[model samples]
Target: MKTMESIENEEAAPRAEHQTETPLESLASIASVLAVGLFVMTFVFQNFEIPSASMVKTLLIGDHVLVDRISLAPPAKWAPFTFYRDIHRGDVIVFLKPGEPDLFLVKRAIGIPGDHIHLRNGVVYLNGVAQKEPYAAMPTSDGDPQHEYNPYRDDFPSIPPDPMYQVTASWQYELPQHIENGDLVVPPGKIFAMGDNRPDSLDGRYWGFVPRENIVGRPMFVYWSFETPADQIEKQSISERLAFMGHILVHIVDQTRWKRTFHLIR
Candidate 1:
């Protein structure tokens, strides 16, 4: 009985002494956690904040969204476990702006490669069929001046783009090359995207096609949303930014759209 008890004490002493991790071991554990977090944020997922009203009811300004970067990315042989798929029509995608590579824009894919597209009276016609876009905020007679129809905006590609409009010079030169039988034909390795707020959005019509490689990811859901001004993104000065940060800190609870928390993005 004594020998048995002695043996048990000897076994228990080592475990008790080792139970409390050394300082080095504790730091190593913390570093491992940080490494995993960094990897997930950089490659697996990313967060973005909407700064414009282009998407309107679909995605409002100041809405922070979680983006799934893996699914839309090109499939890698090393990461065979990750799923990948091609972008389809009507899928809202986040991508770098074609002309301005630094700027990021989110818009719904209207035309994929080889699609014949045109707009008549603000209605999108694809492959000779008019699309039923319930999400699009079309022009209405409700007296909102922003929604009023303009010939160049409503009847797209039919009217020659003028310099008075915000159409890019590069797009004006390339636009005619894609027009066929009064329809804009999407070429290979490119996509035509437009905003949900048709009248207000400065999108594909004004610029050009989005390259397949330029797309970043699809937004999975809105993680947080705050009521912010349309011009908040334009405030670049340090003082102006600090003022807004102070405003957010004070109004974080009340200004936050609690209902939109975790709201799934379509």
Candidate 2:
């Protein structure tokens, strides 16, 4: 029943204030908010993606985690010698990878200052006592790769001569015969950490202890997660434009794991 002039006038009417933002404007506002979030996240809380499965079960691939940044310093981008707090065992931490300053890694605290640690049959022992690790949700079954890469070595790819290799029964970091429990130092301001996936993890064992300053932040929680299609995760791809587009759409939609939406990262 509306006349053409009336309809045109109605269409020309000003929109609500909240609805005035254009798509680009909405994007800009979102970006501004994200920038503010990053500033706070970098200095206050940190956001990271679990790109690898080294900490699987505790942290999964594609899981987004947040970390508190008030505690660590020294090597972090913030300020030097500004130790706001202390790191503790059992706390999940993210750190600048030892030896490789360019890369960052996340793991759980296993050894502390002055704690003698050893790996027996690929199990961790603290102060000569077997420390039960409950966070390792999956049963350890993989064979140890003895030639694990030691990053600290200038040779780069050569394996280090660790005493752990000398054990006759199983894989373990055999403490020196004379190095008593007190000699097992994590140093004055260093921490020893390992991934929950012990066998697959490249951690303190391969690169030496991580300096306290190298720590990035403690992982907070899962903010976002992406699902890998059981078949597509490891699938190789083509370089063609149309083919690649088809591949990407299939990868995103078919792989969208509905059950994992908003799932918390442990």
Candidate 3:
């Protein structure tokens, strides 16, 4: 017969083996789940980065954003997609170029189809009425000079509130007037979009309305963020060099927005 000590030792051996295997199995399961999640995010939910200061105060440059592709039903007709199931006024979005199919862009959807949009004096008007721009933290300063008045003309009129930021053709009064100067109207099956950074952004004022079909998806959140170089990411010898040069490629690999990393896009 086996001694009590011997039997106890035998039982302990299996217990130790099982304990070791459980952790390994759990780790494997975790890795598998993580891989699946990444796949889903790539196919269903896409990510983007803010390239310009166009949508400043609202969306800063270097911000990492998430775009939702699942919401956009596949293409249907020449116009494309299930049309629009439902798109709100304030929802920020990502999309392809209605004019240049090769381009991708992000901007806040301001006016929808059938809305008469333009700058009256210095304010934004929709359908002959002014839109209540709560999001417009900053407004034109003074003068009939507020918005970009004439395309043929260099400066129409504008008065920046801050004396330091005064008005002139060379000054900040210059809004990105899409193709022509002054105000533009949105057409059917298209919407007008503008960036928060009025003076610096090249938006509807330059390219015109974005076609409904070009809309890729709504931005749900800012999943990840990084501070990368303008030259873009290339293989570097060190992390410091990468941070400066080889760094994160927001437009196209890695950047150091350590503070922004994993930070929620709001």
**C-alpha lDDT of all candidate models, in order:** 0.93, 0.63, 0.59
Query: Which segments of model 2 are wrong by more than 4 Å?
Result: 1-35, 71-84, 137-184, 229-254, 257-266
Give the worst 10-residue stretch by lDDT in candidate 2.
Answer: 149-158
| Order by TM-score, highest first | 1, 2, 3
TM-score of each predicted structure versus truth: 0.94, 0.61, 0.59
- Regions of model 3 farther than 4 Å from truth: 18-31, 71-85, 99-102, 137-188, 220-266
In candidate 2, position 265 carries an lDDT of: 45
C-alpha root-mean-square deviation, each candidate: 1.9, 8.9, 9.6
Please tell me which predicted candidate would have the highest TM-score against the true structure. 1
Q: 180, model 1: CA deviation in Å?
A: 0.3
Candidate 2: pairs in clash = 41-45, 66-220, 119-172
lDDT winner? 1
Output the TM-score of candidate 1. Answer: 0.94
Residue 137 lDDT in model 2?
33
By descending lDDT, how would the candidates be arranged? 1, 2, 3
* lDDT for each residue of candidate 2 in 125-167, tens digit (9 for 90 to 100): 6676766777663333344343243232212112333545332
Tell me which residue pairs clash in candidate 1.
Answer: none
Model 2 root mean square deviation, Cα atoms: 8.9
